[model samples]
Target: MMSVTRPYQLTDLSDLMALSATTNCADPRAAYGWLQERWGRVAPVELEPGVPAWLVMGHQEICRIVRNEQLFSRNPHNWRLYNEGAVSPDSGLGPMMFPRDNAYFADGDKHRRLRAPLDDGLAGLDKQRMSRLIRTTCAELIDRFADRGRADLVNDYAAIIPMLAIAGLFGLGPEKRHELQRGLLALFGSGSDSQAGNETVERILTEAIRERRAEPRDDLTTAFISHSNLANDYEIQQSMVLMISAGYETTKTWIAQTLRLMLTDTRFAGRVRGGRMGVDDALDDVLWRDPPMANMPARYALADCEISGQHIRRGDALILGFAAANADSRVHTEDPWLEVGNRAHLAWSAGPHSCPAHRPGRLITRIAVDTALHRLHDVILEIPADQVRVAPSPWTRCPHRLPVSFTSAGAS
Candidate 1:
């Protein structure tokens, strides 16, 4: 059901335009009939005349590209993206996601510098301690919501858990946790009124950064302060907000997606609840059947380079098919149409600009799903299976809301 476009099929600008217009295959494999109709192997369908960065779909090709970091990258702008009124690089959010060597943004030496603080925060006593804390947080949340099965899964469970867990990781004390959570919501939740909400977030975070810098605490905020390279309070604050916001939202989506599936698939639900499979495996199944779609928005070309026999020129914006790549049958041992194991998909992605929080995210995913399965052993999602929908962002896919009933594992 995977379709890569052929160059001959889309021979002209009109054809390319039509192809782009007609293509709405977010997770094309999610609907096989549609995939069979629209999907084809990617040809020299020119994004950049000669330098075609193969939009790999079959699991094998994605794996190959992932392993071959020298070939592809997560960096957004090697080429020019159309002008969208972005501010100058030196200004606020200018040295942001693009062209920054900070951990996820920078490659080579810059990335090494960025990884230190995260490694410190996650290393030694802290890492072990954070896991237990996450477990406790999950238990506490389940205790609070188990009796009330009508809670919103996205907000009540998935959204809140990571905030609390990360807060604890940063050693956020009682009062600070709630405040940090609010700051996070305002910044990340592009709610109905995002403009005002985001400005409020920036204002509060900048102020908080100043305060934290003045009276340095043991949290990641203070850790950023500890770093000599992160001298300016604004950059440190902005970067943290950026990383945490992206990290939080994507993780939230994955959890909600997996939990929703368990709710909808009673047999699958029983398999996890009855301890017939590991939580690791369940997480794998989640990625294959309903992976995140929030990986959209990309960078422009940096130079004219040839990839897979295609010429990619500077100034072109390229979109990678992350979800499709993960599900491609070429790399999958099982029938590509069926649910599969975690064959190490690009859910966390790979490469220098790959997600740095992959370590924490995976462990966190395991802890959350494992804890939930142990406690809420019989959650059955109430929505009709076929009618359950996946919301399409340019990148991430998340259930709108998961409604379910459950048989509690007994009062904790």
Candidate 2:
């Protein structure tokens, strides 16, 4: 089938399909039918003008594609639309959809080689130290607005924790972490200037890599610099890009979504305040309902395949509809009460490409949310719950700003 292209100026945001518009990430129950009614388990969707792909929305079917790497490759080189000259190389989507030397875009032995250093780097982190860093960071962040009695949690707290923690782990100091945060925000924003931001991130990481090589440090950047598998600076830079970009955006969303649930959802609000539901429980709920990355990028089919009766042609791109899969009626129960401790959601994805930093990500989020609630007494949303706006993107769905008001009587 020939690819259909939509007409629009390259500068327009509409030129790119906005995935966040399809459903509400904060409360996905209202949007369950969006994907379910499209095509049984897999649906055809537009990925902007002239680009098309299949979105796998079923739980079991997503598992099949992710687990069976032989059939579905993660390499962007295999994408039919891009390879066939339909999607432009300079298209804003190039950063995510194009091939790179990192594990995110590689497969087989090369994938393992690029992935090992990251796994090892994260494995070596001191959990106790990380906890201290997060608590201290959260405390300081809260202190900034404690006197004001109000703050945009999304920008003031939830948004900054991950980058600070991750950057510290990567061995960057306070100033560099702020710089990294800015570059990352722009890269993930997917706005008209996203490509420029992507290039800036590369330059920042390249400099960091060069500095790390010159003077070794106890950070992830140094680990990547010394890792044997990554042969060049470009490879190391791309690997850092993968780790930082993925870690920052996903964990930020997790923090914001978890906070949203605790503040707005009565079921969780009551439990969290009364000590009936732990922060971990709230975090788990967010994973099932509003995962950090709602719709992951692409997984190209190496050859013809069929999933849930949908014909997948060779070189076709298939998106892992993780949020959709979690809500699949087949494996997921409709009742929230019964789902206590049932962590069957595909939020971290599965198979070889599953998120490796989930442990630390959870640690940062848990500390941030727990610290805020502990410090802020009688916290409440300043605006109506339904008034919160989500950022425009084809990937994750996260609250743009969570303006919250609370009493400081509980502050130490």
Candidate 3:
């Protein structure tokens, strides 16, 4: 392991780009490319203004980081800034980077213990039942705007379906599911309402857990409550939070990005609509070019080390650059023909903490996208693709809105 001889100075910090700012840009890849050109694979980044961390952009470099957890731990307690109290409690990064009882912030044996319930809960899911739920949810949502012939694909369709499907798996009623969806949207937004959203999510899950405990039902919530690994109510509640939030956000983004590609990219538009290329191809392509979670938060250095020639000190934070790594020339090519079925991209990430819900996530996304295209005739973007904006967040780069127009389903 190697270390920098001196601490980073204010002058050094001035040159680093704000990670959130870069992701919020319309052309983030261009900015990421500039970072790679100037700083190589590992570059200094600020999660918020003045808070420094390393953003690992190289495909191989990110692989090395994720696959070797001994050197890089998922536990945020190891983060020097957070530990030193330098990171404000009210900082926008709190909801994401702060320690939680869930598996996302755990490491080693504890991580395995916390993660078991999620895996087991997901394992208990009946894929056939889930697919049907998704299809039904999609139909109901589309029915809202299908007659109107104009829709914001993101809000009216893509964003609503995943949560409703997930809610069905948890056995939540319509009212509760919509409430959970609203809370999660705010929590993931990482804005002023994030803390309030976190509270709302916690309250909802706690109530659901209590309900499941009094009388166990054959649903994911009951499954989590009954899992041997979950020792108490708090653990069970946190696990539910992790599963629902991660699953909803990722699936929503995946559906939106895939639809965005199909409507905007000529290569996909021509083939998918003409039935020349399958929707699955477009989904895979989105995973490579614009993954649901563009930038993930994060891994902390367990010991001083060097990555791609950049010296990192012990307890330093490392943000996973999934979108940037996918764009790495070493692993990915610009040719659409070559990118269609390639699954090597780190979209689901890698290692022990890799996404547990990817299978369910994909199923939900596929059904939502397939149903939308099938029901809507000749759907086209209302605004140019280049003018489309992404929601502001330090992690996850999904379209803010995808307004599209199409033939009314009720047309004569």
Candidate 4:
């Protein structure tokens, strides 16, 4: 398909068949940079595809589309492209969130109903309980390599915390625990090769759902199934999908990127360590500077809408760049491109689907960050970042390996 462009450019629309064509999951930002270069202003620009669609980029525009449920919808196109194949009429994921059919997909009440149980599960911080678990995990990991002076930050440390925390929440066992940490990394991680891995990962989750049903245990999975009033097995499967997607990918990226950012900008790192930049500023800085997911795909139009002066045909798929929009200066007076964080940005999202679990997610992030701030005496990059390996996926960014050295640890 040909790349989409504004009417001013004399490009052939026939070349751009649909939204999927321009998007290369391997390196999405490349195409984003290309499109941004083609048309000016980071506002939601149409990619001039065979099918009429608009990608909301600027901060305000993304906010507009996500909030305007009346006009924009998650199931915009009749067809959605996935790794295996294209799903139409039905989401292929089956009667789940963002249903393809208009009535089910567009109904706000339905969305709220589904989120109710999920919301309840997210409640109850139990800071004392959770903090103890997090610190212990970090301490154990640090002990393993304290003398080695080298560890892969993502695998050896950061990635393990969420799963362990999530495991405690779910009460998963060590045997056949089915670690979502690595699974999600592969699913949304780099390379087309992951398609096969994604399939296997989904299958494992599917099997776990089945086993949990027959022999329900005292865990988050059992709690979710019983609490959700789920219609059938597929819905149960979707919960696993949502939890893994929400809990794993984003958290991993944030940790990897945050450490890297602090490495490059020690001044900022010093501020965080000294309790000067403080928690809110430090977290906000990373949220603005290194958001996990850059853009989210497959938003349906609830009704025909116009954004940034373009007439979007109803039901047309709208692509949104959470990172780009958050970084756009139009919505923020401060120079966002400079990676400054005096102002907040929309990394997770800003509208109805703006991430209901964001509050808890932030708490978990705090545990990790605080562990580093108060525990590790100083920052040490074992494998100079230039030598550290990078994962190839484009939609989300994370370091495959962040070898590092740190002083003997202590607790806050």
Cα lDDT for residue 189, model 3? 72
lDDT of 4 at 121: 60
lDDT for each residue of candidate 2 in 180-200, tens digit (9 for 90 to 100): 778777777777877787787
Q: Clashing residue pairs, candidate 2?
A: 5-50, 6-49
Tens-place lDDT digits, model 3, residues 91-195: 888867888878998888999998987888889888888887788788888888877889999988888888778878887877888888888878877779988
Residue 4 CA displacement from its true place in model 2, Å: 22
Q: Listing every candidate in turn, what is its Cα RMSD in Å to the true structure after a full C-alpha superposition?
A: 5.7, 5.2, 3.5, 6.4
RMSD of 2: 5.2
- Give the C-alpha miss distance for residue 96 in model 1, angstroms: 11
Instruction: Give the clashing residue pairs of candidate 3, or none.
Output: none
Measured by lDDT, the strongest candidate is: 3
On residues 309-334, what C-alpha lDDT tens digit does candidate 1 reach at each position? 33445554444556666656655665
Candidate that scores best on TM-score: 3
Q: Name the regions of candidate 3 deviating beyond 4 angstroms.
A: 1-11, 183-203, 333-340, 410-412
Locate the minimum summed-lDDT window of 10 residues in model 2: 1-10
Better of 3 and 4 by TM-score: 3
- 233 in model 4: Cα distance from truth in Å? 4.9
TM-score of 3: 0.91
Which residues of candidate 4, in runs, are more than 4 Å off? 1-5, 8-53, 76-107, 173-219, 232-234, 302-304, 334-344, 383-390, 407-412
- Separate clash counts for every candidate: 28, 2, 0, 14
Ranking by TM-score: 3, 2, 1, 4
